[model samples]
Target: MGSITLTNIQKSYGAVHVLHDINLAINEGEFIVFVGPSGCGKSTLLRVIAGLEKVTGGELSINGERVNDVSAADRGLAMVFQSYALYPHMTVRQNLAFGLENAGMPKAEITQRIGEAARMLEIEQYMDRRPGQLSGGQRQRVAIGRAIVRRPTAFLLDEPLSNLDAELRVSTRAEIAALHARLRSTMIYVTHDQVEAMTLANRIVVMRAGRIEQVGTPLDLYNQPANRFVAGFIGAPHMNFIEGALESSNGTHMLRTAQGDVLHLPQSVAPGAPITVGLRPQHISLSNDQSGFAAQVQLVEALGSETVIHASAFGTKLLAIVPGQRRISTGDTIYLSYANAPLHLFDQSGLRIATVQTEDGHSPTFV
Candidate 1:
């Protein structure tokens, strides 16, 4: 009953176009997250689905029924917002009952729903407290409880954790995950925080400038990004891009960086063609010997179990994450290598190109 589909959905604000040709299919009981940078139209798309914003074009369907003309109140969807949006004067129990009371639900049913939701959210003790009397996390839970009592077709959360402290965000995130597991209901969450999207989503929708970039499982987006943007956006500390030009000699391909460091290319490309070499920070390791290129350390973060190093290489900034503690410091010269590690290749247009390594350890073949 929670299935949703968007067909060529587009949104515009008078002269400014926001969303562009968005097409997606969301299945029942799926937890989908929409994520992107600010002004990326993620929230706008969510509002469109919630029936708060009118679409400029195309169709929106929920449970195989076209809902483009439906009002937000009639859409059978409950939305939890970032601001906790609770009535300051009303107690938690009253807040949870407000919607049901307006819908002409029986008092007994409203009481039953409120009791169940409060207990499920572990907020039974705070049922009589006003929102102003509770902590941020408690208030957020009350907000969720309010939505839970509705038993809506699906849930829509718009950066609901953005207002909490870091520690509270973590704990509340866990609770939300558990709630979803218990309910197994469709949930569409929107957030600019990639960490939240990564931890909570069954499938993530990557958006940019109002257009959907890529939609996939968390690991799928991490292990196999569709383009340079997705590769850079999906990972922590992001991927490092080194500018280089492809060179060919004796039928062997190589990439020569702007800093004059040469790396063997597993695939062939047009000689002197501009390309970008992408390597994740975790994939790079500090070389004990001089087998790799030298980089000047810019900063060091010794994070107990692992160290994050910011260095300069290939005429650009580089970041390398290594395991355990090291005596490395700023201004120190270090050798780095990524031999046999997975590499991402992008052409002049920033599109990904496939590369296959040979068993005999020769240059990679382009498929």
Candidate 2:
């Protein structure tokens, strides 16, 4: 196992900078996930860690040793890319043992490693088949198996589940998670899928436009985002933001909506300031008795375990998540209420002003 540390790390192509001033410490045997949209420098950062891309500045250390100028092979990290990157003509067994053979391991050692990895990965059944003969999930398992045989200090996975179908992706994701639990090796995975990030990561690194926005545990980021972007980006249905006037003149913070409605904030908010009222779909509950803010349902999405109600509130679209097939309808007028405190509060600059927890704080995440 190995630990990874990045201090003020940066990357660029020509004059365009892609990653800037990244400082992170990844503990040995931790499963770290880098998640963001396309062109967000996630892959670029991963490549830099693998020594596949040169760092323009700053420091990168693996196992307490600087490897900025080291060759990819010398880094002793195995990278599993989105593309399977397997030898098409070779059998799975051949592919898994090829690297060891090339490294001049004895034939016995190569065979032993291959057998052990296959048993660990449960791909022994397909070991003799070519990549073409296996299903997509099986093929992916073979690719992972190939990397496993190397037994590197760290494993770098770049969207390895993207190529699989939805069902296969689910099973394969669980397999990967279980693999980490069993192997207990340091693994860094990159993906644009927040579901993958939320489920697989011990720590999720949220990035935007070439820089890291925030890093936290799944629920920590979900419950208390650092900014508006982090709040909206990390959730599945995303968070609902209603433009309103912030008022804290009374003992409690309240927001007056544009359509002549006032919603009480869960935490203290600065008075008489312009702020966006953010309520996640899950936090908003529906009441037919008109107890809260009035909204007209616009659409309904049923997902078996929960129903999502999309409505227009104070002239802005709002989403409310109701538990278990709520049997809601379109064009139905309903009242909404915030189910919790700790609402995400952000300044005009998009940085969080403070959490609902305190009267004064710089970032919501600091709570």
Candidate 3:
């Protein structure tokens, strides 16, 4: 029963509105992540749900009961913040037991909860040590143990790994995922790193300018983006977009890039209509022959498993990812060909438009 629901959620600061029209339903035990750029209102929205801030409009409910007026303590939730908010003078065991003590739990029950948390987080060896004696990862584990000892209905984490080094972040990230699996309690985590959101969340809530742009599973958002903004934001090297217009010859629809390279499309569009063709770096194929678009390689990055080529082709810059190693120099000329790959088309308003035929012989509509 650790569900959370929001309806028409809005927030403001006198004259400036920070969050607008946010609506979502978080199921019990589901791992949800709030992700966006800084000032995009992801953290602010998390605070609103935690009852740390007042909602400017709409209603919020937890476990089927309205909680907009509920105090932060009464919401049956625990939060782990970016900073390891541990008591400097208190030992790990004392810090873990602090919340239960304040809530007036029996001493025996508090001890049991602290013991379980310490064991679960693998911090039993450091229970007698103060925060000053612990490493970054150890302190963070103690912080999480403090939250876990409360046995709350849901957990709210706000960039809890930001303070750790890269290696520690990865390990802690895996630890958190395992914790979610073992406990299966509702968890809402906020992070600006897409990698964390992709690996941690059951569903990701991508926000922008105080608005939710898209909400879906990581693979869903990656494979079927709703718009240009989402397509550009979800991938690593990002999707490369080439400005072009539609052309038709003998009922065959083609997209002509600004550099005069023609691309055959599966869907028919209005002739001479403005359209943007999107190609992911991995989708672009390279060839030694001159049959494809001629391009000059500008740079080459030889990662152990794959090579990334930065090239100028068809009057626009492009990135091509190739398997294995290729002896490609910066000044080498290569032919680029992209065939049998999914094509993303966007109009002037950055909205996705689709015309490819499905197996049922009908074109699907874009979202």
Candidate 4:
């Protein structure tokens, strides 16, 4: 019963507000990750849940118990910070036992807990070594082991992998995922990296400017974004945006790009209305034909498995991801097109317009 709920959560420092009207329900045994750019308040929201920072407004409940007024130590939560907050002078064994000793647990029980956590984290061999003798990953494991011995209702992790190297981060990320599977306790993690959020979380809460932008499974937000902000934010290399206008031709709706190209639309929009077209780079196909849209290649990235071409189309920069190592080079002209790939249309307000268009001018509703 480690579920957490926040109702109209708001945090402010005098006249400056940070978190705004945050309402989220975290289920027990769920792995939830809060992700956004820096200063978006994802960490602040986690701190609010941990009672490290008092909320200026709203109610926080852990397993149906109100905990806004509870002290951090009494909130039944354990936090692993970005900095491995281990005592440098203390051995790993001592670090794991420090909290239990303060809680006045029996010596036998404290020893048993330390053994269990060390084995779970697989740091038994390094137990006698002080923090100074361990690698960054080992120290982080010790930090996590310290939290594990607490056995709290939920684990709050604040960018715990940010300090590790690229290789270490990937391995440690997997370790944390495995730990969650074994523990099955409610866990809330915060990171600015969407890749971490996509891979680790059962559900991701995307935040921006002190408000929740969207919340859903990684694929849910990827396949069908709620708005232009999310459609551009969720994917790697990002979704491409092209300026266009909605037009009507004899009762048929069409999208006319700024480059004077007209595309068929499946839904009718207000005539002469402005809209933006979003296309994922992977969805675009490159061809030698000059009949379609012509783009001037500005840069070519030949990744081993895929080639990403950065080019300019209709006075706008665009990227197209094609398969395999391409022989194309910078300053080359390439034609681009797509087939059956769904296009994301955004209105003037940047909200998704659910209209699927085809080459035959027939309208099919996009799911």
Candidate 5:
């Protein structure tokens, strides 16, 4: 296992800068996932770490040594790609043995490593098959097995599961997690799927528009986002947003939505300030009563375990995840309320204000 540090790392393609002030320190044996929308530069950052993309500026240190000028083959990192990238004509055994062969290892050593990797990946039965004869999941296992045989200090996976089926995706996710636990090596995963990021990473890095927005564990990013974008991006059904204005007290907030209704809050907030209130779908409690915000059900999706209720409220559509067998139909009026503890408040500028008091007993604030 080895630690990785990126200081002021940057990338550009002639005038369009893709990464800015990218500073991060990853501990040995830690699994860090990079997540963002397409064109957000997640894959680019992983390539930078693997020494595949040349950084226009900044320092990269691997295992305490600067590796900005190191070649990809010498970085002691193995990369697995979405396409599997296996040679079509080579057997599974050959695919795993190719890299070690290039390094001029003994034939006995290469054979031993390939045997161990095939056993670990449960592909012993397919050792003689070429990429053309194997299924998608099998091919991916071969790709991972090739990485394992190298015994690299760090493993870099760039959407390695994107090509698999949904069911296969889940199975491979578990396998990857188990692989990490067994190897205990530093790993970096880049993907646009939040589920992959949340399930695999010990910590998550949320990026947007070529910049890092927040760095935290899965629950940290879920419960406490650093900005509006992070808050909206990390949640499953996405957080509900309500436009409002500053109320009577410094912390108290009120909303007069376009649906011709008013909402009063107990917390103190600045008056006359335009703000946005965010609440997760799971945080909301739906009821038949009209006391809280009233909504007309627009659509209802019933999964086996839970139901998703899409309703029209305050002149906008809102989604509520109703747990367990409860069902609602379209055009049904429903009430929505949730605890304030999970409520998110964003300023007019889209920045987050601290909701808790400071350690010195001062009021907690984001401003």
Candidate 6:
């Protein structure tokens, strides 16, 4: 009953287009997260689905029925906003019951639904208090409780945890995930926080500049990004890029960097074609000998369980994350190597180049 499909969905404010040709299929009971930078039109797209904003073009369907012209209140979707949007004059109980009361639901049923939602969200103790009397996290839970009482066809959350502190955000994020597990309802969450998207989503839709960049599972986008933008956007520390060009020497294909370092390529491309090599910080290791590229350490961050090193090699900036305590410090010279680690190759246009499999059915590695 929660299925939604958008075909060629486009939105515009006058001539300023916000969403461009968005086509997606969301199945029942799926937790989908929309992640992108600010002004990427993620929120606008969510509003379109909730019937708050009309699409400039294309079609929207829910449960196999067209809903493009449906009013927001009749769309059977509930939205939780970043601002909480609670009525200041009402208690938590009143807030949860307001919608049902307006819908002419029986008094007994409203009480039952509010009680169940309050208990589920752990906001039972604050049911009698107003939003001003509750903490940020508690108030956020109450906001969610209000949505739960509606029992809508699907849930839409727009950066609902953005107002909480770091620690509270983590706890509240966990609570949201747990709620999804229990209800198994279709949820569409919009966030600029990639960490939240990575931890909570069954599938992530990555958007950039009003266009869908890629859609896949978190690990799929992490391990196999469709482009340089998705690769750089999905990771915490992000991927480091090195400018280079493809070269072939004696029947073997290699990538020769601008700094003159050469790495083996899994497949052969046109010789002298411009390419970019992407390496994740965790994949790079400090070399004990002079066998790897020389780098000048710029900064060092000792983060208890691991160390993050910011360095420059071959005239390009690089970052490496290594485990455990290290005596490394700023201004030290170190060598870095990512031998045999997975590498991502992109063409000059920032599109990923597919890796070829070997006779052993394994993709070749960088050396």
Q: What TM-score do all the candidates reach, one by one? A: 0.96, 0.93, 0.92, 0.95, 0.94, 0.95
lDDT of 3 by residue, 1-367 (tens): 3999999999999999999989999999999999888999999999999999999999999989999999999999999988878999999888998899899999999988888888888899999999999999999999889889998999999999999999999999999999999999999999988889899999999889999989999998777777787777777787888888888787667778876877666544678888887767887777667665678999999996999999987578889898899999999998876644566787878877762422211122233
- Report lDDT per candidate: 0.89, 0.85, 0.86, 0.87, 0.85, 0.89
Model 2, range 249-349, lDDT digits (tens) per residue? 44666677777666665444558887875667887777656555678889999989999898998778888888987766898787776644356667677
Per-residue C-alpha lDDT of model 1 across residues 67-158, encoded as one tens digit per residue: 99999999999999889899999999999999999999999999999999988989999988899999999999998998899999999999
Residue pairs whose backbone atoms clash in candidate 1 = 266-364
lDDT tens digits by residue: candidate 4, 170-213 = 99999999999999988999998888988999999999889999
Residue 8, model 1: lDDT of: 98
Candidate 6 lDDT tens digits, 1-367: 3999999999999999999999999999999999999999999999999999999999999998999999989989999988999999999999999999989999999999999998888888888899999999988998898889999899999999999999999989999999999999999999999999999999999999999999999999998999999999999899998888888777778778877877666655677899887888988888778766778999999999999999998568999999898899899999887765677888999998853322221235433
Report residue 91 deviation for candidate 6 (angstroms): 0.9
* Candidate 6 residue pairs in backbone clash: none
Worst 10 residues of 1 by lDDT: 355-364
Among all windows of ten consecutive residues in candidate 5, which has the lowest summed lDDT? 357-366
The parts of candidate 5 lying over 4 Å away from their true place are 249-252, 258-260, 354-367
Could you give me the TM-score of model 5 versus the true structure? Answer: 0.94
Model 5 residue 98 CA deviation (Å) reads 0.7
Higher-scoring candidate on lDDT, 2 or 6 = 6
Clashing pairs in 4: 266-363
RMSD of each: 1.9, 3.4, 3.1, 1.9, 3.7, 2.5
Report how far off residue 219 is in candidate 3 (Å). Answer: 1.0
Task: Point out where model 1 deviates above 4 Å.
Answer: 355-367
Considering lDDT, which of the candidate structures 1 and 3 is the better prediction for this target? 1
Better of 4 and 5 by TM-score: 4
Clashing pairs in 2: 248-271
Off by over 4 Å in 2: 248-253, 266-268, 357-367
